[model samples]
Target: MIETVIVVLHLLVAIGLVGLVLMQQGKGAETGASFGSGASGTVFGSQGSGTFLSRVTAILATTFFLTSLGLAYYASHKASAVQEAGLPDPALQVEQVAPAPVLSEDVPVIEEDVTPVPAGEDVPPAAE
Candidate 1:
């Protein structure tokens, strides 16, 4: 249950991070405003949006990292629990089947006698 919650939270944080990153304007956008493009009007003022968006992005990134680590930990812990319950580890389990006998070159192979017909010959019907 806890792992499920963490996974959901992790996915949400990842999506949010993507959205937040896409919503932020590129560094080149500032250059346009300086050339009198009248791009100075911003919702979070001149410099405030940068700080706020950066801080939010940082927080989301941290959350994403934490959730990633948490999910990894839980997965490993569950695997170990299964191992502790006397189930063999798949990596260590080896079936002791008998190896196949290697064929030697000394073995004789029988070949069938096949005859080829000429290309322009009138073909005869196959015998029953």
Candidate 2:
């Protein structure tokens, strides 16, 4: 149950990170525009948005990394638990398949027998 929750949270954070990164304007966005037009005069002011967005992105990225590590650890632990409880380790198990049957020389093989005709005489025509 905890693993499931962590996975869901990790996915949400990843999606949010993608959206936030895309929403922020790149440094080169205002190269051709007037300085005034490029200015952000809102609550975040000129430099606040850049710093705030970057900080939030970092936090989300850290969370994503932690969740990934956690999931890996949990999976390994669960597999070990199964082994400790006497259940077979699927990776270590080998299936016993039957061997193929061997052929023997005792069985007789059929062959065609023929006699050559003498070369000088006219050969008799085969009857229909």
Best by TM-score: 1
lDDT of 1 by residue, 1-128 (tens): 99999999999999999999998988877776667565457676655367788999999999999999999999899889988998978778898999899888999878977678899998878778
- What is the alpha-carbon lDDT for the whole of candidate 1? 0.86
Clash numbers, per candidate: 0, 0
lDDT assessment of candidate 2: 0.84
Cα lDDT tens digits, model 2, 2-71, are: 9999999989999999999997888886453336564566677656477888999999999989999999
lDDT of 1 at 63: 100
How high is the CA lDDT of each candidate model?
0.86, 0.84
Off by over 4 Å in 2: 30-40, 90-128
Off by over 4 Å in 1: 34-41, 90-128
RMSD of each: 7.6, 10.7
